[model samples]
Target: MNTFITLAIVLIALSFVYTWGAAASRRVASQTGEKLHSRPPYYGLYLVLWCAIPAAIIFIVYSLITPTIETVIIQSYFPQEVLNDAAELANQTRQVESIAGGFGMFGEPAPYQVQAAAALKNVEWIGKMALVALIAVAAVAGTLVARTRISPEFRARNRIETAIEMLLITCSAIAVLTTVGIVLSVLGEAVRFFTFVNPIDFFLGTSWNPRFSTTGHGGQGDFGLLPLLWGTLMITIIAMIVAVPIGLMAAVYLSEYAGPKFRFVAKPMLEVLAGIPTIVYGIFAAFTVGPFLSTMGDAVGLDINATSAFTAGIVMGIMIIPFVSSLSDDIISQVPQSLRDGSYGLGATRSETIRRVILPAALPGIVGAFLLAVSRAIGETMIVVLAAGNSPVLTANPFEAVSTVTVTIVNQLTGDTDFASPQSLVAFALGLTLFVITLCLNVVAIYIVRKYREQYE
Candidate 1:
């Protein structure tokens, strides 16, 4: 419903943009003998952006904050008798919402409804109507204003170009803001988790049993970080061991050695590996690769479980191959042709040229690719959930069962889990840690890519 309303608003705003641009063009044509500076479409885009961008931002902000505001308002609706009791406060607010909802506040009618239902309906209606009206008005005003400014002497082309540049920068800023928002949300939940579990105990302790209870009993929770870290590192290292060499060789062959036809066929075929979903990879790892490894281990007189870290890591590595290969290929291709020619002119073989020259030139990019691949392998959930045993144990053996942070999070948050409980809160803490690690890796990737660009350019 919200999506449909947003789309409708955008369409209406677009109509206004067109109207504004046409009016401006007509005015300009009347004012001057010369043709308009640019096409009508560009003028329309300028007006549309002016009307739509600020409105879009407001809509997004309102959508995010509305839930929190509603929660506070509903809490305020509860009588003081309910409010004084911390335990009752949550339940009573829920009951109030249930009563309001039953009265057709959000859906169909039921029994006991109140003024809250009407209030909610009013709020929803006001939000949609206001947004649409504001966008339309802004669009009309922008069109008229731009048209008034348009004349033979006016630099419409320059103005339009500058506006587009600002829009692009705004888009980039939105992406960055979105990332920051995610991190902030994770941090907020993690802070809540830390309130129950001591930060030191959460970080350093070996045991990770998050079972907080209201029953003031002998058993408290143990939110440790070490065992999960060990498991994550081991699995990630095993995955990198499998992925790095194969992905690099595939990239090298495709980018430099293969003929055009071979490259065309092989590149997409190799990328087909990436197109296969992670869940499919998980099932394959659990049912197929696990058994195959067990059989091989049995013949070799090594004890290995069906659901082992090695199995999960190997499957994850296969999933990450395209990431490494694709990035490496781009970097390798970016290496100047003159360098390879110089190497060949110095009597270097193709293999020697690639080994000594091309690889060196693309080292930063290759490192960046490897870092990205590692981050991916670290964050992979399904493969580990299926094949890597969910035993958060600190072990060095690849053939042994282990679990990663993502698997632990999935386990804790699955099915009907209490959100306020320590178990669910732990998931947020793990998520924050995961986000931090990935952010660091991304920073490194950007730095490496920039350094590589500087070196080559």
Candidate 2:
């Protein structure tokens, strides 16, 4: 609440500074009887940037460091035993912060905890005041310095544009750094997992019975990836079999044949599938689709499980249709009208033009979209979890239940388990594998998109 109030104060200060700077600039221009380099609003925005940017940096830096500082300070009051254990120290710090903020603990805290909480409250109060003072100084100094610089020759527009460009670059850098962090963190944990289990056995061994598995030195139980990997592939292939052709045809019809009114009505309705929760899809598959498929199989003298990969895949494909259709429609629509006109002038029919000209032109983007949808399919958890039936058997029969890498990852990590055990560590290994696969898919998709985009350009 204090931080929010501080933010409000900073915003109000910035607004005042902007109004003052804009009026001051206009006054100077009128007095000098010279043309202003940029509009008054540009000057106002320029001053707002100056007043807000430094103060934001200070506030952010203080906000990030203050908790760690408080934790360390409070730990000085912790009992020696608590201080000795990293986890205990962390728990104590959380308790102190909670108690200091008047949230009240379940029981009366120790004398040392009371002392620590009091000290923490004071430290937080001091930190907030210091933050406000720093922000005031930065804002006032920026307003004074920037307001003085607002003259007829000041290039406020150019400066503001450059500032916007820098902001965009900073956002891009943060995205890249986040990806790097994820890869490194997953890779580190996976390396630890490898120390406990053989990579070859984990990848090639057929069985996936990780329960009651012996840890350390030589792994005892089967920790195989083949069953999960095969199940994942089966579901993905089945989904693509359903999604690709249907989605592509839908895109073609919508882009080429549908009237404007129909297209307008249909597109959002189709995209609505994208917004429906996967959990709801899981329920739909489990209760409705699964039994329906099993009965259909029974009518045809074929065995089928109520919750199998086939059931999950059909629903998963339906879920991803929007991804393929929406992107393919946009890509096909982007094909130059001149090309279509030329095809028509050459006496080709609509279907021929669509097949020979438009599809070929949009192939790269369509392929990219397909790969992205495949990635989406591979990453799906809830639908697969509920519909794929928790079976880790290595089997080729779609009628039988089988598990997936994602399902296994969820199972391995769920509930209270010792992280030191190989069972838990295997989750990290599975995660890294999934990450690598999806990353490769994304990279290929990006390459295809960029390569053809540049060629078209």
Candidate 3:
């Protein structure tokens, strides 16, 4: 059956099971005239959890193993020579899978390949059927086990709560482990890259033209970091220049000055800019803002490229405006009213009160918000990719076309390059560097924000 169809069936079955469980629980409670540990709905929820969890686990396990089974069965039909060569084996296996799925075969498939494809289809169908059966079996077993215990004496509420707690803990552990896995994977790839390119050269060098590098002096490529690093910082600084004042002023106006009606309407309208996809922003920058700037620059007797650090930065700054405005508004609003009241009692004007009391109180959080915006700017990819003309040259001019770490990472990882080569692996190094930079910035921002909270709260 189709995945969606199966899911729908499962959902319908679960709903029926829930109704059955609740009705049965209500009958048990009423017939025996005993106070239930929980209401009928809680017992239903407990049964639903028991049925779903085991079924989900069985489905997941079956899905994971199906591919391996297909591979083995397909390999059994292929010649030893094809199986001996890893590339040939992979290619043939892909062809088999494609033909089995009724696509990707340009012409008639070979006899053995067709046979293998047929077998693969059989195996996949068997796997799917087995998975469906296993899920049903597991769900029924779990339901029966739970059903026997579902009496007025059973603490279904306590059991359901405990299950929910475990689920939450599992989710937390999965998130932590995922982060750890990413760090380890990037570090491992970076180590592989470092073996080919000198760590010092990769980190400190000024050039960044990456191609195939021989294992010779400095790994034979200008895999420098400075040029890309400079581009990233330049664009980020320009973004901050554009974003900070405007976003903060917007926040201040909304929180401290604007009428409630205007604030309600205007704030979301401003934030709508943030909700626009970065790719769309990039396209706008490239096609609209970039040309607009270039025309304006030419009118003013300046030579500005359509795609430059300035263009990308301007668009990125616009994109991150809500990050600053929304966050600053929250922080600013959180400042205790007593501080404003005290400032007013001391014969302070609104502006003076804001400058001396409210701002100082909320400074750390505002700083944190700025840093958050900075982090967002540094990590942004599409705006730089499409707007910032891909020139990996170190320069101080805002008008110059420049490439950033994120764009470089995308360029390096694209195409059929060998992952073991420094050319491809450099992407990981660039990614790791960004991760570290953002991580450090986040850590510092969090520390500052927390300290401010301690004083304020």
* Residue-wise C-alpha lDDT for candidate 1, range 1-457, written one tens digit per residue: 5789968966885887667676776677777667776765666666666666666666677789877766676665556676799987776556556664553235543232255445655666777687667656655665566556656555656777897788799999999999899888889989998887788888888887667555432245677888888888888988999999999999999999899999989889888998998999999999999999999999999998889899998999999999999899988999999999999999999999999999989998899889989988988999999999888887888899998899999888998988887779889999988887888888878887787768666
Clashing pairs in 1: none
**TM match of model 2 to true structure:** 0.92
Which ranges of candidate 1 are over 4 A from the true structure? Answer: 1-31, 34-42, 47-138, 212-218, 439-457
Look at candidate 2 and give me any clashing residue pairs: none
- Best first by TM-score, ranked: 2, 3, 1
Task: For model 2, state the Cα shift of residue 231 in Å.
Answer: 0.9
Clashes of each: 0, 0, 0
Model 1 backbone overlap count: 0
| Candidate number with the higher lDDT (2 or 3) | 3
lDDT of each: 0.81, 0.89, 0.90
Query: In candidate 2, which residue ranges exceed 4 Å CA deviation?
Result: 2-9, 76-88, 214-220, 443-457
Q: Answer with 1 or 2, whichever has the higher TM-score.
A: 2
Q: Given candidate 1, what's the lDDT at residue 223?
A: 73
What's the alpha carbon RMSD for model 3?
Answer: 2.5
